[model samples]
Target: MDPQTEGHTGLGDWTPEALGAGRVLPVVSAPEAVLSRDGAEVDPIADETVRLAADLVATMRVSPGCVGLAAPQVGVGARVFAVDVTGHAKAVTVHGTFVLCNARVVEASRWKVGREGCMSVPDLTGDVKRASRLVVEGALPGSGQVVRLTTDGFEARALQHEIDHCAGLLFLDRVAGAHAIYQRKVYL
Candidate 1:
């Protein structure tokens, strides 16, 4: 257990280095069956799980404006996701880069609406209501160590987005109506 994470809610001295040398995988687009199907829970320490975690991080890094990526986005039917809100303007609480397995929201508050886009749904963006403050719990892929994280702002939003993806949801699924969605005007 990370000394910082042991007694409190935050990723203190924890990292995903155990899943080393990740390779960028091809990102799957919308309407793909995997994105619509709920992902399966997996053994966090299993080799395949670790490999997927690594790949998620690698892919997220290369995708422009992609601060978060989930396993199903890469065509894997597993509850794993990677997040890095390091430089996002909307991010208030940054976590650098991390991957979580079978993550779920333990607490959510401070509801707010924000704009969201997806690699899968490339041509559109939508306004979705999500919690601005959040608490999440999940196991780290390689070590299988469970950790709790309390975060707010964009990092929290990113976490919620990936968790939704694992649950077979897209931002489109959460939008108010067709009026809430917008055609993308910029790429990057």
Candidate 2:
């Protein structure tokens, strides 16, 4: 099973190096069967989620400036996600790519929408409402660490976007309106 062209349930374009580098994750759909609607159980994740997150990292690594990736963007409905806010080519000590399962937004700041985009809906990017900061709680793979992350700035915005996908919501759903949507002037 080549990872690249696999169905929405299969992980695509993922490499081990990408996972270590913090790439973006592909979203999965319901029919793929790798996803379980069960919110917070410790059951094993479908192979699709594992492989997709790895592929997401690989894709994000090549992209100019991606800070997060969600499952829905890949067409899967699993509660899985990944994020790495360390900007491209910047030598910053604060950096890590998080793989999440059955994650939830425990706390969020007042609406502070920021410019957002998605790998799935790549045509248009827009300003969308999101918490200025968030406190997310979820189970980490392997370690079973019930981690709670408090993040803000670009990282926070990205996390919120990816997490939204896990809940079956897209940035389009939160767009202020058509007035706020616009196309990328250049593919930078």
Candidate 3:
């Protein structure tokens, strides 16, 4: 898929080089050391980082039931993630597809309880309380333009989830209690 068509026009110029390097990265799962480690800020303009962002998007597209993915989940300790909630049943705000570098949640409000899961921790899911609305600030890959995204509903949840990965936290860490956690149901 052309990364250019995925919402952010700033990324169009770098998409080719990003995808030119052949190799679809494998998603790192739980018990992997990288998933638990905090990610470092990525150089948004660097070709390598832009390529990684493209790989993240490619990886997320191939993974079933995945609406988002973090660099840590792919064994890269860089503060980057890709999210796309388009067409999701629970999505109230669709962002199409976008990648962020050095992302942070600047504001979050309207807390709500929701079931959360992760690509890294695939075996489990949990009920975690997260903000229903959020304002995220980050640099767009390739362009290095800082962008702020305000969203709510499922899109907000997805953002929070990916941001947590950058901070070395997981849904399991936010689970309300033992009762709040459960074995994941097969998406298929």
Candidate 4:
């Protein structure tokens, strides 16, 4: 697949083999050094990196209630993440499914506190203060062209959360205090 055109519409065209979509990579849990260590930027157009990007999207789709997944969470020390906010109750600005490599928040504003959880840090949930609006920029996995995403509300929060992972930070790192953290609750 051409990396340049893969995710121009947010969600890429790759799918699981059965569905003819993409590959689903394993999710790494907390306490793993990779989850806490900073990620290095890689050539987005590399075949390995492109495959990793597809794996991120696939893993995020299969995980219940997951809106995003970062590369480090999959044991890759590269700056990449996949996010899809469709049908999420908390989502306001939906971006469908998209992968961002070497992502960074260029602008953020309108702070708000929201409860958050992570696939890596599954044992805990926390109330995190984050910007409600954000302008994020990153390279497209296959094409290496820089793309900017303007989003607000839940999508903004999800973007920030995943970007934090790329920076070797977790929502736990952003929680206000001990009182802000709680045991994760299962929805069903």
Candidate topping TM-score: 1
In the range 58-109, model 1's lDDT, one tens digit per residue, is 8888898999999999999999999999988888888889999999999999
What's the lDDT for all of these models?
0.90, 0.59, 0.83, 0.84
Task: Report the C-alpha displacement of residue 25, candidate 2, in angstroms.
Answer: 8.3
Q: Candidate 3, 73: how far from true, in Å?
A: 0.5
Worst 10 residues of 1 by lDDT: 1-10
Our tally of clashes for model 1 stands at: 0
lDDT of 4 by residue, 84-153 (tens): 8999999988867788888888889999999999989989999999999998878777767667788999
lDDT string, candidate 2, 72-154, tens digits: 55555556666777653432322366666677787888677677776656667889988776777665543334556666666
Instruction: Please tell me which model should have the higher lDDT, number 2 or number 4.
Output: 4
For model 4, the run of ten residues with the poorest summed lDDT = 11-20
Model 3 ranges with Cα > 4 A deviation: 1-22
After superposition, the stretches of candidate 2 with alpha carbons farther than 4 Å from their true spots are 1-49, 88-95
Measured against the true structure, the TM-scores of the candidates, in listed sequence, are 0.94, 0.69, 0.88, 0.88
Error of 3 at 29 (Å): 1.3
Candidate 3 has its poorest 10 consecutive residues by lDDT at: 1-10
Could you tell me how far off, in angstroms, the CA of residue 125 lies in candidate 4 after the best superposition?
0.5
Q: Rank the candidates by TM-score, best first.
A: 1, 4, 3, 2
Query: Candidate 3, residues 62-164: lDDT per residue as tens digits?
Result: 8878999999998998899989898889998876788888988888999999998887887898999999999887887877767678899999999999999
Model 1 lDDT, residue 32, Cα: 96
Candidate ranking under lDDT, highest first, comes to 1, 4, 3, 2
Residue 22 displacement in candidate 2 (angstroms): 11
